[model samples]
Target: MPPTPSPSPGAPGRPPPERRTDDPSAVPSSAVGREFAFEKRHFDFIVGLIHQLAGIALAPHKLEMVYARLARRLRELRIKDFDAYCALLESERGAEEVGFLVNALTTNLTAFFRESHHFDHLAEEVLPELRARHADVPRPRLRLWSAGCSSGQEPYTLAMVLASSIPDLRRWDARILATDIDTHMVETARRGLYPAEAATGIPPALRERFTRRVRENGDTRTAMDDQLKRLITVKPLNLLEPWPMKGPFDAIFCRNVLIYFDRPGRTQVIEKFSRLLSHGGFLYLGHSESLYGVSSSFRQVGPTIYRRV
Candidate 1:
């Protein structure tokens, strides 16, 4: 799919039908004091829609958070209440808003080498094993997938580590696929510009080599160097949808994303990853996620890291 464009702030192409004012279902009296009329029905629709669209299962506890996040959209579009907002989502005209809605609701919390140990393992163990295994290929290729890579940090970090580990990196074919369901985040990752503080987690040497400070709109920001950018391709991808790439990735980093999915959803996604992975390739998950009952295709080889069996 092509990159999703940002939604316009103007009202939807066509106005939603005016809901009956007297209907209790349209606007609950209890919502009278709130900034927007967010009833139980509206929350339910959001939960179901996000799950169907992104495979994210939001709990009931996230009701307030949902309202808080989506409320911004309401204000932006000049939408009166959740009733009209949900109607717009359900209508044909609302298709464009879908991207914005998903962008708003999806959580994007990432940093440069946020999970330090994963990179450590990649540099020390995984790279050595792959290096020895592909020693004979005329032009050995290395492919990695950072599934759910938010704002490009994970894949950029992967690029830095991959370049650092292999002395003949330029001689070999190497690419990192960075993807996220959120189109906005994909755009941000493509830009490869970040606040200076965001680079603190990266080692000083790597940071100095792979990134540089630039003035953007009068503020100094860190921009990823072309050397690092060349190794990564960022795209908007919904994991729940059919993937377009044919992959035999040497390693797949899908950290933290599975925590939002239920057991069955998690299993299905893991199975797809297993299919894309090269034999015995590595799969990395977040610290809180595990595949104990999700699949038997992998064996625990390190902390939250699995190797295809």
Candidate 2:
């Protein structure tokens, strides 16, 4: 899961999207089992489009998942069948709905500090080494990227850790870049608002120092403090596309985002990360993901954590 809340589209470890050209139907077959007619061709088209757009490779079994997530859009647009839906996507005007399509299929499942050990490593090991290395500098510069920041939680967590670990944080040029392919999640992260319950996973001291409770209308919510917000810049970025920013980031947290991509796509992204990272910078991956047989640019330093070699 990502920090902010972005697409955790489907379960991890399933096969990559299947490529099939044997059956090509412009219309749905005569199957009356569901609310919408989701033919294999429709699924295949979707698979191809999503892969092209976002680098997410959908497995063959994701047919139901794709149908279920996109069905609401069909209903909202008042489209009748999968053929029509696919046709619309192929249309010139379909460009607008493409964003919505990507958003709909993407799910952001995250917590304030979903993976505690990573934060522990950041606090205990990473920052200290950086501080020592930068002691001669007048103002140390630290940049971290929450690459798949879902809603906002991950980068905010990074901010908290930075604030607490570095006593001279104000003297350092510290910033966190939080980006997600889902613009909806990027906006959500920019707002820095979350249900009060989401704050539970955050450590008590960090939460108290970095977050505040706000009552909007009749509902209570948690808002990140300006101090923490100052350290983050949230933006929408597709990992597979051309990047605008120059990097050499001190660290990159791209947790749980790679599971949706096929091996080649995953390898490409990681290599890009490696290129953008500082020589000794760290790379963090989701628990179920690994760099094994993917790349040799990093050396494993901790559980799912890597240091650039």
Candidate 3:
């Protein structure tokens, strides 16, 4: 079934949200003969806090997803049910759990070169122009931001593409700043290790150029070659908060990150991104999102690609 958009918190919703699924992994419910206490009221409080904290709107249908994800937290903290979880979130003591909660509930689906066309455009069009424009300067500066760089794929891809496409990559002042709201993701990205399977999506030539295999205890892992790794800086950044780094970013890949935000929040982020761009710099969005009715600062240049006007 298609995922439907439900009303926001404080609006009318189903009476306690009845759900049916045969998936054995589902949590114990407050329903008949079940132990789960995730009633409508509990869900509203949790989701409302998510909105307030991260500007992500949780649809009513996400009750199961929320419960499944956060149920582990309850187990880890030895809390019994959703009611207690909600209380802890509201209390002064809840500050730390808030981070854990956001980490748990946030969705991160990413892969290297997941949207191949964006990298193609960068290699074929964007980098060449930036290189020519900066050639006359003594210290050429290039900045790229992977604003929601989950698990490092996007930034690592950017690094690889830049290394291959730019003629004098090392001489230029070039860096890819990859940031994510989830602390764990930032750490994982820093490690630059991936299971062998993750390499399949990456093109063979780029993979051969930029990655190497490492073996530890019979596990063969693919690691980003240091040449590629040196060009990236990974750190935690909450997009809703003020960004610390000054930027005239040559390109920014903020794909799939804005869908979680409400309209006003998305608009604010788009404007901020525009300000960060170098004149005529590129912004890459997820395929499903668009700038229509959101902002006029950018004009579409390709599928899911936009350039600052």
lDDT of each: 0.86, 0.87, 0.85
Report the Cα lDDT for residue 65, model 2: 82
Poorest lDDT segment (10 consecutive residues) of candidate 2? 10-19
Ranking by lDDT: 2, 1, 3
Ranking by TM-score: 1, 2, 3
| Cα error of candidate 2 at position 258, Å | 0.8
What is candidate 2's lDDT per residue for 1-309, written digit by digit as tens?
Answer: 122233345522222333353444432444346787676767777887788778888897777788888889999999997778887877888778878988988769899888889999999999999999999999989999999999999999999999999999999999999999889999999999999999999989888888999998889999999999999999899888877778989999999999999988899999999999999999999999999999999999999999999
lDDT of 3 at 85: 75
Which regions of candidate 3 deviate over 4 angstroms? 1-35, 216-218
For model 2, the stretches where C-alpha displacement exceeds 4 angstroms are 1-33
Query: Which residue pairs clash in candidate 2?
Result: 3-154, 4-150, 4-151, 4-152, 5-150, 5-151, 6-150, 8-107, 17-58
> What lDDT tens digits, residue by residue, belong to model 1 across residues 205-232?
9988889999999999999999888999
Instruction: Please identify model 1 stretches exceeding 4 Å from their true place.
Output: 2-33
TM-score of every prediction relative to native? 0.90, 0.89, 0.88
| Local accuracy of candidate 3 as per-residue lDDT tens digits, 44-99 | 77787778667788897888788778878898999987767777876789778888
Candidate 2: residue 165 Cα off by (Å): 0.8
Error at 277, model 1, angstroms: 0.4
- Return the TM-score for candidate 2, rounded to 2 decimals: 0.89
